[model samples]
Target chain A: MSKKNALQTVPCESCPLRKLDTLREFDEDELAFVKTFKHGELTIGPGAPIVMEESNSPHLYTVLQGLAFRYKTLPDGRRQILNYAMPGDLVGLQSSVFDAMNHGVEALTDMLLCVFPRDRLWSLYTKRPSLAFDVTWLAAREEQLLDEHLLTVGRRTALERVAFVIWHLYRRGRSVGLVTANKIVLPLTQQHLADTLGLSLVHTNKTLKKLRATGCIAWADRVLEIRDQDKLLEIAQMEDTEEARRPFI
Target chain B: MSKKNALQTVPCESCPLRKLDTLREFDEDELAFVKTFKHGELTIGPGAPIVMEESNSPHLYTVLQGLAFRYKTLPDGRRQILNYAMPGDLVGLQSSVFDAMNHGVEALTDMLLCVFPRDRLWSLYTKRPSLAFDVTWLAAREEQLLDEHLLTVGRRTALERVAFVIWHLYRRGRSVGLVTANKIVLPLTQQHLADTLGLSLVHTNKTLKKLRATGCIAWADRVLEIRDQDKLLEIAQMEDTEEARRPFI
Candidate 1:
């Protein structure tokens, strides 16, 4: 991509961040400082590791295109995906606090990222306290989402959990204008969804079948189409209130 | 207890956190400003809810004494404890971005809290940017801990998960000078522990027995005493890196 196109594809404008007002409130000079960031792409086939476990070097990555999964492997070789990073989603915010990553991130497709050097970002935060505040708010928001994930893994039934995950992803995609009312490009397999949800592959398959039977969602050609958005929300136990879909700061 | 005695009981002077230098960097006026905070108590007897789901309250709470857990109840009556908040820990920091809470916090003991209203805190941040930095750093540290917990729940076995939880609690207690090297007080019961770890009660019980049999921990009088910290860490697959223990800023 040309430099101009690369800058346009940075996904910053479309990010549904809760604290965009704070970011936009930045002075021209401050915005210019952030605008200096460069972007890059990594052409990795399926199953290529994007970030390794216990690595000292860390870089903040914002997805420009394609999919990636953050996961860790147990001693017995079982893997659990922490989450999936999609377009406009930023990763490595936690790595900013820690010196090393405890888990690994692997690309499930050829990926593109707007990469920021960790030290430079830290320097920016030191010079621009407002940026630091924005970053902190973003991390706090991530924590809130993790809290919800803990609930899904701990209490929700396999079907409810799966429904919840799908609904969450759909809502997030919709917020970024990546999805319509009923259609979303899921791009994740039953196994990938299973790993993310902490469920067995068979269980994930069964849950998807159940949802399909109920006309809550349909799966074909690597896309998930929500057949009944209202019913899906009810199954996920999500409120129609603004609170349920509020953007994280 | 007298105010002075209560402050003494907190052992602020002896805290490793005091050696972190962040607080020491504060000027006299800043120190005096924070010292002016009045200590208070929040009592919610066992099973009393502290923060309810879908309720909007703009306050951040610092635990003064006692234990509390954040949880969400499912439609089928299943509950998952998202986290256990201890003394000196923060609760509801992320809720400031939202108009309502998606999860509920309830006391395991009659809880005591140092409540900071969000508006007042934000005003303070505007005036004393450095204090805001410190508070944001503290919130970031909590996010790091939550990330580690996510790894444990997503990847580790039931036995390893329980062991890691206990080990983490022990380490946190040590950081706060609440425990010695080998002895620690565990205030939560196995059932409560099970809920937090996303394990069945029977599975949690079996795991505890296994740990006891391995001579890594001893459970008596509702307390878990670590006999071999190294062995416990090994079983938990935890890295003993300084970064893991440090309060990240």
Candidate 2:
């Protein structure tokens, strides 16, 4: 099946998560209990706001297809992308900490999302502590990602930062079976990449040009294709650990 | 007893942690069981390395006196200070994830630390699941701090970043009863401050000079004193929230 069709096949009752090894730790009854959760799909077009700032809506979302970026806008209208979410990844996990979101989430492309109500999730956690633990673990992982991003923003060079991001996206794609060898398609704009890296648009474009000039990567048709994976990885200064790779698969 | 004298009174058998309200959530037997494990204290001098990189010694430490910086150094000798640990704070909680430290921790002053072996702590967790949950919660709290730091590094200016650091240190000091109404002492050096903020030493000094000129804060002789906290808070762009303050108290 095509990627789009495969994602559409994902339903609340027949979610592939039930068969995943990560959920194998849950017993038959626990699985059935979670399966009872209500699910709804949200399709967000490019540049559309998925979760608005200060919105008290308490639905937790999981990315089913396409990509989304979470960001906060400054008073001057500049944006800072806090994180990027991909398929099978959970977003809005921190919403549990507050009554409303302090940041906004926007779809980077036409996307699909599976959402669950916070109240129902809390009730499920109360009955199955293991599920709660899993949720907490997911939050912890997000925290780790934030820490790594801090290091990148604070210390890495512009080229290194861009390479790190591309390497990261490539690794995530590889794990989700969207990548073949070192080549992967990245559907992000230079402006969005700059926001995520905390760099200016001009600097981001310059860095990408350098990467392409050095025969490191190719960017065309809004898709990024890594050419020299080893050279790019070295420039990115990424630690080749299993944990650094995506966890979805 | 004065705070300094309180430091010398090492009543391992009667540590206040046994009576802490958070631990009270555990049963009496569990408290006694945890207390039976001997606590060892280690003193580290300024610039002394406390934890080595990539060495997997499994022991969790609690700061009893003085200060330390958690950092990861790159091959080129660029260091990023992840966070600072003060009295009553737990360090090395990430040791649960591996056998060796991915980062190195060093003493910023002559420091005293209370050590708990990983095996003993793991045993305690097995016996009391609540204890494990509490540790996880602490880890989660650490993650939140990292997230805030990420935001600081990603978007905030050099001056704003320093102000945020000072504000955070002052708030932490107040939470642990180390601060009075309007004054707090910061134990970090400008050089260390630069490392933490990912700025050059000269830039950090320039920022400090600016804050000093504005009479927002004062730093000398390794002590940072907040002069006008309201102004500093405003400059730091800190949100006034109960959750931003420590919840343990």
Candidate 3:
């Protein structure tokens, strides 16, 4: 990981993500405090650990660019990817609040992150409940995502689990402008899909091939193109998330 | 369903759960605000719906007594239980923060809930950052629980999942004074376990029977007795949660 103070680079006042129509707007007071709350920027290459399991970091992070994922490993080295992180998604919140990271985070792509000191996180709550609420809001959103993930893993058929993940990722990507012309750079290996879907690598491979045979989705060279969104959603047996302006830290 | 003004029964000033060693102590001012935030008391019998899936409720709730579980159903009626709500757990947090209950909450036993009108939720944030932080803390803790739940469902084998759930519940129940003499009255049916472990009823029965053959646990008539906690943990391959004074709303 490499880091330098991000003060000179795009200030929080002009942060591009804040301009997105999908995010709730922050008032000047909230924006000003957030600007000060930011410690600096850190950039890391793909496949680097952003946070370690059961450790503490001095900072909290918001993904300003690129994709990352949070995961936990078993004693035997089996891993389960909890969810992915993207721009506007705050990482290390468990560390910021409790000073411990219960799970590990790793970048899926070269990433830019806005960092905030954990020491002052309390002050943000005390001074601006609105922003504090945003923090809670973000946490609640993460919990909701996990609920969806649990459902897919626990109850869905293997094929349904694969379909739900792709559809879910597509919706998340499109909301963040990462999708273009029905395609997005997935940046995931079949092994990652296996970890995410709770399936064996061989099972994931066969399932993906079966889904591909239907021609609803095309995955090649890390690019996933949705050939038929309706068909994909139908097989996933899920609805797209409600289109609402979401809060972020 | 039943409703009565909790003000006349047990005010937030004397909330029993707040006095437990497992919960953090609140300042006088925070306690005072919580007293007003308490709208009333709600009581329901077993098999009651505390909150509905995809619906909105006017109030947020804290489980003051009894056990409840949150769940979501697939389009075909298959249910996946997300987690259980116990004492000090804010039940309607999704509703409290966003005015939406994305999952259904149901009582597994007679339940007592401390009500907080959702409309005043923001005012609490504005008035007390400490309390706001507590709310966020609770949300983060919930997220952590879900992460663990996801891991068990996604990675563990059938017998391992059953053992983990039992061990996990024992620890949670023990911490909250619900366990006695290595046993707790687990108000769960076999079907609930089936839903929770993502296994079929026949599979759940067989797995429980297999675990039982090891002489580590006994289940009869809604009561689960742990004959060997250490052996169960060994099979589950999970460490107990770090005993800490958790915050709550």
Candidate 4:
């Protein structure tokens, strides 16, 4: 990913994510600290590598726009997509905290990120208790997602797995206004969905077709439409875990 | 689980976990705050529930000794073991931060836990930046483990899946002196292993037998003997990821 050097800084007061209804509001002083905390903005195109596994970047990021995924590759070159990063999600806490990245991240769509230096994160903790709590909240929220995904990949049937992933993306997408009227432009290939589901390409295709035939979902040209959210949840045996108010940095 | 309420406080300065070489040392002031932060001790027998899914407890815990696992269950009564908790691993942090527990935790053996009030966690962060950093580090570390397990359960062959779990447990067990001479009195059943590997009981048993025949491992009664660490890692395609110095709170 190449950096766009001409800086068009978006001031904290005018930050787009802060305007989302689902996110909690930051107080004046907290927003002031965050304004200083942000290093700059980063822009990258679809499918560009954002962070490599086993390496640390000096910066952490918050997704200002677009989709990305965190993944890992086995020795045989098989990849497992761990989870997705959406608008307002923090992208690199593991690498920033431990000084070694255990997974790689790549842009799934044309993206913009607000960058923060890793070292200054400590100062945020010492100076702002509420924001520090928010940082831990984000990390804990991530763990909760991983725990749910592990359950899905490890025990759910093929049909159930496919349904769950779509249901999750739908809700997260709705929260950030990326989706509306049961539809979103999900920047993902069927192969990417296959990798995320732990299913082979042919099997994932069959499962997707089965769901579409049931009129629960439809996919074409990278757009995902949840035709029947209730039917999808029934197959997935899952419901919304989204909090009315969510935190983001 | 029954609470044995007679007071037997293990003071923070003389805490057993603090003496471990693998853990970083806390300073006098930090130690003083921890001593006050800790409410008391908790003891539970084997097979006891430590925390329940979808419910939040007022207190959070650290495993001072013994083994436990974090897991989730499907509506059909099928289960998936997400990951294990060892000495020095923080438990219930997700619930503490988010006020919702997404997974249940159970004791694999007789366990001793250090209890801290959930409300007090915020004070720790506000008062002590280093300890707050440790809290984030612990959370990040847990996420790292989940990422690795997702890769293993999602993509590894049955044999590799079995090897990876055993190798991972072996290394973590060794860290706190729970394992010795390549053997540990493991407190898990074949069904538990099956749940962990996301394989059927019969398939899991067959894979275990195959590994046994290769002289890489031996499991009789409740004892697990890793006869060949290198051979096991080769099959698992995993190596030790333990940091030379780690943090615990």
lDDT: which candidate is best? 4
Among residues 3 or more apart in sequence or in different chains, the pairs in candidate 4 whose N, CA or C atoms overlap within 3 Å are: none
Across A77-171, the per-residue lDDT of candidate 4 in tens digits comes to 88999999999899999888887898999999999899898999999989987898889988988998898999999999999999999988888
Q: Which parts of model 1 have CA positions greater than 4 angstroms off? A: A1-30, A37-48, A123-127, A240-249, B1-49, B110-112, B123-130, B239-249
lDDT of 1 by residue, B1-249 (tens): 255335433332333334543223546555555444323335557777778877876677777666788887776767777777777677777676555677888887776666556555544454555566566667666656666777677667888898888888877766656676568777688888888888888989998898889998898986778888788889998755442333311
lDDT for A142 (candidate 3):
90
What fraction of the true interface does each of the listed models get right, in terms of native contacts kept?
0.41, 0.28, 0.78, 0.74
TM-scores of chain A across the candidates, in order, are 0.82, 0.87, 0.96, 0.96
* Lowest lDDT block of 10, candidate 2 chain B: B240-249
Off by over 4 Å in 3: A1-8, B1-7
- Going through the candidates in order, their DockQ values are 0.45, 0.31, 0.84, 0.81
Q: What's the true lDDT of residue A96 in model 3?
A: 77
Model 2: pairs clashing at backbone N, Cα or C within 3 Å: B55-B100, B56-B99, B56-B100
lDDT of 4 by residue, B48-111 (tens): 9999987888888999988999999988888999999999999999888877787999999999
lDDT of 3 by residue, B1-249 (tens): 125452447777777797678888888898888877788888899999999998999989988899999999998999999999989898888877776778999999998898888889999989988888888888998898899889999999999999999987888888788888888989998899989989999999999999999999998987889998788988998876655788876
Clashing pairs in 1: none
Give lDDT per model, in order.
Answer: 0.68, 0.69, 0.88, 0.89
Segments of candidate 2 deviating more than 4 angstroms:
A1-14, A17-30, A36-43, A54-57, A98-101, A119-133, A244-249, B1-45, B62-66, B98-101, B110-133, B242-249
